[model samples]
Target: MKSMAPTRKLYQEIKDIVLLSDHRSSMAFEVSDEVLSTYVPVAVYWIFSGIYGLLGYLEGCRLHPKGAEEEENVASKLQVLRGVLLQQVVQIAVVTLMMKVVGDEGMAPQQPSFLVCACQFLIAMVVLDLWQYFGHRYMHVNKFLYKHIHSKHHALVVPYAWGSLYNHPLEGLLLDTIGGSLAFLLSPA
Candidate 1:
């Protein structure tokens, strides 16, 4: 009989290869100067939105202390802080991948107008959302896995932007990997 250990190892190796390939393909598509320019404004919006969102939440908590539990507020704030840091890491990875894939190539196409960009962004967002939902469900179903990896995320009952970042490093990695892979795979030919 074929050894189960060898089979498992082989499966893992294949999974890694698929993940790397997906990442490479996505990076290649994203590396154009045009893509960078497009991505930058979106990134900036994300940052400002986070800041404003947190500020609003805090103000609300202060104005309506009875509506917000102290412990939940503290946990939400901590989660948001952690999320910002994690977002930075993700941005770096995305930029690095873009640089690698776009090397020496001319800037991405400037024409085809806003419609194309909008469609692309919409598709990417849809794929990412689906991936996150399914991946989160997977993490929850496995008790041992959930306790060790995803428990940190659930620590905040009242979530904030930072609550997104309050997860185990492994869980963070898994979420990103899954989302990225799905996005790449679902990209138009």
Candidate 2:
């Protein structure tokens, strides 16, 4: 077995550097890490959306400019927003179901070591990427899926941060929500 002594030492050094408190979690209110995990993704989504939205305003940062023929948006902002909202509802339902199924005992009280956490994150990324890749490819290859479902996402001519989440409700659930849930469940704690 690989010795965990070095890993523990590195984790302690990281804790000292970050000045993390053992008694307190990152949030101001007392909340379990398991519960906090659910909120983290939502927070990150908005944070990235904001960053990408800001980037859209910068000409130098844009891959395709506003006037480009190919970059024009076919779907209206309202349409995209509605799709996003619908997907969010589905996502919330899935998350609620997952939470209920897992219950309080799902997560351990002690946090995983930094190295372990990093490895888990890497694994999750690979799993999610693979899931998305195959799922998306399948959707494209299937005429019924592309026309009725995947095409909703393709309606956005110019990809923007806010529009990134705009997907058909079913497609979003299958490609994103299920893939994410699988990644979360499959990853070692």
lDDT of 2 by residue, 1-189 (tens): 999999987776666556656543344245655457666777787788889878877989887867652447788877877888777778777877887886566545676799999999999999999999999999999999999999988888777677888888889999999998898888887
- Where does candidate 2 stray beyond 4 Å? 1-20, 23-28, 67-71, 106-108
Candidate 1 deviant stretches above 4 angstroms: 1-70, 73-80, 102-104, 177-185
Candidate 2 lDDT at 94 equals: 85
Q: What is the lDDT, from 0 to 100, of the residue 185 in candidate 2?
A: 82
Clash totals in order: 3, 0
lDDT of 1 by residue, 61-161 (tens): 33344345445654556555666567557655765575466444554444555777677778888998887888899999999988887777777665553
What local lDDT score does residue 89 receive in model 2, on the 0 to 100 scale? Answer: 70
lDDT of each: 0.63, 0.80
Q: Estimate each model's TM-score.
A: 0.58, 0.76
